[model samples]
Target: MNIRKVLTAVLPVALLCLAATARAATIGVILPESYPSADQAKELQLGMTLALKTWPGDAAPKLVIKDSGCDARKADAISQEFIKAKVDVVLGNWCEINAGADALRAAGIPFISSNAERVKAQDLQLQMGRIELNAGEKIAADLRRQTGLRISARTSCWMDFDAALSERVDAVLCPVLTMDRGRWDQVANTYGAAFRKPFTASSARGYAAMEVALNYLRRAKAMKPAAALKETQATATLLGPVPAADAPAPTTALQLVFAPHLPKLNAQQTQTLDKLVKTKGCACPGGTLRNGCPRDSGPWGELPFVVRGGGTPAACAKAINILEL
Candidate 1:
């Protein structure tokens, strides 16, 4: 499918009118193969439904969900089918989804982008001139507020992967993104999301599957691609860090990281940290390491086999610092 074609297919026209006499609009939603995760998908679906419930007007947009399977080729075919079906709009739900939306656009249809990854944003806006996001920018701002910290390109599920934590020790804070694998699943289940009216989360915020299609379709009613993009940028709002209360806080938790290539520590401070490491695994104070300790040895090691899954560190939930060892 070409760009213009799919966009027009996906974005519903106002044909489903403000009149009760008119029919509803068809909004086709394309998503990642395993997107939003299983639980996340359901919650997102619920969130979209909730938004539609309060949408201002006499008509509601109908949702048709399908898994794109992360295949670019498949996405192209899907986009074409939606266009053939005369869909009002089609929204691509993952950051790396193919350029079929451009095909839809070229075909004179409006496409809604649901990608939130940095690479995706850069490629979309730079290449297609059709781009939107959810939390990518806000996360950057949040990262800037953090001083003396840098992120690891390494994608391991390390405890300190979030660039936000290097600023402090003792009492630590973590981003839920770290909970994607391992025992993190149970931990992440606690949080949820909701949106305000005008429903920026679906449209102006991150690219909402439905809103992207709708907004573009509505605007296409008047402007060209360049004008539509200008309008989108002018209007999009920050999506995540939702309401502080809506998303769950990282549970009272602590993790350790080595203070790499640092100045030598004083005797007394070093001694105190070393003491904690010996007695309490490695929860040393002031983010320093405990003296004479081996790596990856936490209090949970006492188990005959294992305990505190994922190799719990030696420090208490409220850790003091990394071990000098």
Candidate 2:
């Protein structure tokens, strides 16, 4: 071959090699706790992995997953590692990432999250794309409408909101936490309490959202300001009933749902309770004697539930919308 021609071919090959090396992508994943009920963070990992499996390239992006403990401190640590590793993309789960979400944004990295807990709206990394589960709220709403159950200010703590449940359920669908004592629920249902285990989950869309985030990164091609904006928009608009939708700005924050174990008093129970109310002068001031007034031991072995709004089966389905960010 001519000397000039050989040099030209060699330069092209060298440039191609450099380009290939530079294009290698890196993906990091962060998850919250994984115990009973829904582990959205784990679901995110599974979704991302499934998508990575289908990627058609000899140099697939590095996939790294870390736990966030559903705690702000833990999320900060995981985010720090991701920063040091210089990951091209990240997807975090639950509310844990809220703490480090700002740092990531300052670093100009993009991330997708599945928790609706209130967080700084200005941060760019904190993209509220995937919802964890809106079905819980919907179920609560539907239950209220259909059952016409009289709700109490207190909600079931079996799915405690402060720790395990969300704090947005409305009247007749109060928030519950796991911290509630077992005796409480037992006491609540000594009679025909007709209690329903408030339902929540890692949910069906858990994995799919992660896949969406990964696919978004692959398609973005560049991480410039404009491209990041586009990705942010895409992530902000994720659709589904599970994980719920992000609360729109200026929109009232979703209200909490609280209902009694015996939300709807059986008709016979109501009539019996009502007679007791009238005979015992339930409306009377101070304590009245059981024989002549309202008493715990009634015709049936039932005690009036100690709660706000006592036993009025007023429908409360029409409550503020709860959008899970």
Global lDDT of each candidate: 0.40, 0.44
In each prediction, how many residue pairs overlap at the backbone (N, C-alpha, C within less than 3 A)? 39, 26
lDDT of 2 at 131: 20
What tens digits encode model 2's per-residue C-alpha lDDT throughout 1-325?
6999998989999999999766767777776645322444444444445446544544567777776665678778888899898887677645443566667777877766655433444444544422224433453444344434432333332122332223343243322211124533332343113223211223223333455555566555665733754554543212322222244321112223332223345565445434433332222223444434444434312221111222211212111111110
TM-score versus the correct structure, for each prediction: 0.43, 0.50
Residue-level error in angstroms, candidate 1, position 139: 16
Candidate 1 per-residue lDDT over residues 26-108, each given as its tens digit: 77766553633443444445545654554554467777777665567777877887878776666663434444666676555
